[model samples]
Target: MNQPHPSEHYPVIIVGGGQAGLSMSYQLQKRDIRHIVFEKNRIGHSWRADRWDSFCLVTPNWQCRLPDFPYQGDDPKGFMLKDEIVEYIEAFARKVDAPIKQGVAVTRVRRGKQDRLEIRTSDGDYTADHVVVATGGYDIPIVPDYAHSLPQRIAQVHSMHYRNPGQLPPGEVLVVGSGQSGVQIMEDLHLAGRKVHLAVGSAPRSPRLYRGRETTEWLYDLGFYDLTVDRHPLGDEARHKTNHYLTGRNGGHEIDLRRFALEGVKLYGSMAGIQGARLEFKPDLRKNLDEADEVYARIRADIDKYIAANRIGAPEEAPFRKVWEPESEPLSVDADEAGITAIVWAIGFRPDYRWIELPVFDGRGHPQFRRGVTDAPGLYFVGLPWLNTWGSGRFLGIAEDTEYLAATIAERSASQRAAA
Candidate 1:
């Protein structure tokens, strides 16, 4: 594609054509809004580049639906593998006829006068009245500084680099971070015949399902997953604590620490430090486990109250009822015996706004925006973690967020047109 002149202007330009970007594009198309999406690679690069060979979305096909495209598959509760998701996203772009310039990597985004944005890219420079940073949140993987001191022999890989069992070395693997990625990686490595030791952390206790239905189904029915940042009282609190949102896996499978125990995946307390070949760990898992249990109990009580107030009937109880049970005991393991050969950091991800030279970011590096409008007028952000809700940044959840953002963009564009 030929590079446009630096002075050329587009009505709207979006960076990073992932799920969030695509969704925003779909909404714009529906509104007959002219926009261009600049993608670093082909559409769905993140899903295509993700290393998990056997990776399946935790959310089922039903919950994976986007704004204009609904997931059409045999299993509503079945997890769509990585490849399937990539194809779905590509198809969505085509179906909506979104104007996408693939393989164009954005180098920097700066605010221009009169609510304009200056976007510098590998292909060329372009100005847009509105810019949506739909880059998504998981662009960067976080590895703690403590990991730097590990012995030369101990291999360390972030979860993003992890593909399948074949990529791991023989013997035990130490999976750090008890988040969904860490737990899932530990499960996969263990199932692949490698001894695994999981380092626990402060993780939210989420039920796999509720009332015999998929947890996602219940959440959708109860409008829990539909929560927006505007309506959620705990949005600031939740955002302050965690940057990631936990979703339920498909096929009614619940992820609980007890399940790891049942599968013989050795669990360890929080990792203190790693020196040479030895990894130091806290002796007690009681405090962390207890805290998680309490949180889960409070969530359960809230759900129960919601059910009673709404008079919702309980369906047939599921076999995975044990997930709802309280944590009974603290589990610990010796890092030496577990044969943790590699430490896979599945901790979490943070925003990389270094390339964005806008003065809209707060002290913590998150963009300053209300809805999708930034302090610099035409500069906008969409698909950011908790941009507008508990689920605003999620797959099915982005529809409402995009609609709101697109309307705001249109309003701003109309006002500009009137002035012109």
Candidate 2:
């Protein structure tokens, strides 16, 4: 007490308090391991803040499983909305009774003397024998460089900050990037009766329902969720792929850009540049729409093949047909003339590991690791997209990944004890 003790120490430290970290903590407790979880904000902050008001789990409720704490709601097939998702996470955190330090931000993590990791946080300093970086991949919101060129008159906000259509300025809204967030936000605004000019990106689309089953259910039965990243056709590149856009809103439904177009939403190609008050778009509107439809068809076709192979009694359905097409590809639209007063950049996010002063990253600043294990001794990562399989990034597989890490950490701790 007189010396103020050097610094707090633990056998293991987790950098995030999200589902991944909590799951890891649960496993560690079961193994009788001591650890702590540090979170910048309270648990479930991202799900509470980043997502829009209408946000819900894109996957079915049956997949909302945390280590042993599976979804117990009556609607196994219904998607849980924003508040429900937060409550689920908070419930898990409470159930596990994870030793968490909320509101404590980890600013830096570097190697310390004697193979211990020094962690600099807002509250105080600490050290640990092993450190697990459970921070999810979506750290920094990405807005294009041309965003700066946008006139100040037009309000700009990333999709993370967007809450609802009411938050936007009244007028036509130009939504950039047609990924999950982009397409959904566009629908949110369009449903609110706001004029929406969609700058469609190359994100693929998925069918919400097919053959009287959710697309996720069909894919699950097809072993898609269990497909490890290593065995994927894209290999590690699969991690960088954009998720196919769908929705779980109002009992869930497919998000078809063509259908939106038919319903009066003006669709444009990917944004190319900003020229004065005019915004330029690529001439690939048709190409983007067609590619998205191709993905939709491929998914249905795969499901059909699986159904036929198993001789299932699923209803036979007709092939996908184009519902609408653009008559002309408008290359440029003057924002002022279009009455666009706001732009929501749903372009997605990038991981910012600059705070991690470790040499375990690739040329693109992405952490280099096999699953969650890195070459750096006693250092690991979790909660990354495709960390092990397609489900690694979602609630569907966090428990399995966490279990693997807990076992790895336990084995290392045992070996150290034996050597001592």
- What TM-score, computed on C-alpha atoms, does each candidate reach? 0.89, 0.97
Best by lDDT: 2
Badly placed stretches (over 4 Å) of model 2 are 1-5
Model 1: number of backbone collisions: 6
Misplaced by over 4 Å in model 1 are: 1-6, 113-115, 230-233, 243-250, 315-338
Candidate 2 lDDT by residue in tens digits, 1-420: 112669789999999999999999999999999999999999999999889998888888999999999997899899999999999999999899999999999999899889888899998889999999998989899988988998999999999999999998888899999998998899899999999999998999999999988899999999999999899999888888999999888899999998899898999999999977899999999999999999999999999999999999988788789989999999999999999999999999999999988899988788888889999888899988899999997999999999999999999999999998
**Residue lDDT tens for model 1, 135-201:** 8767789888878887666688899999987887776788888876887787778768887777777
- Tell me, what's the RMSD of every candidate? 3.6, 1.7
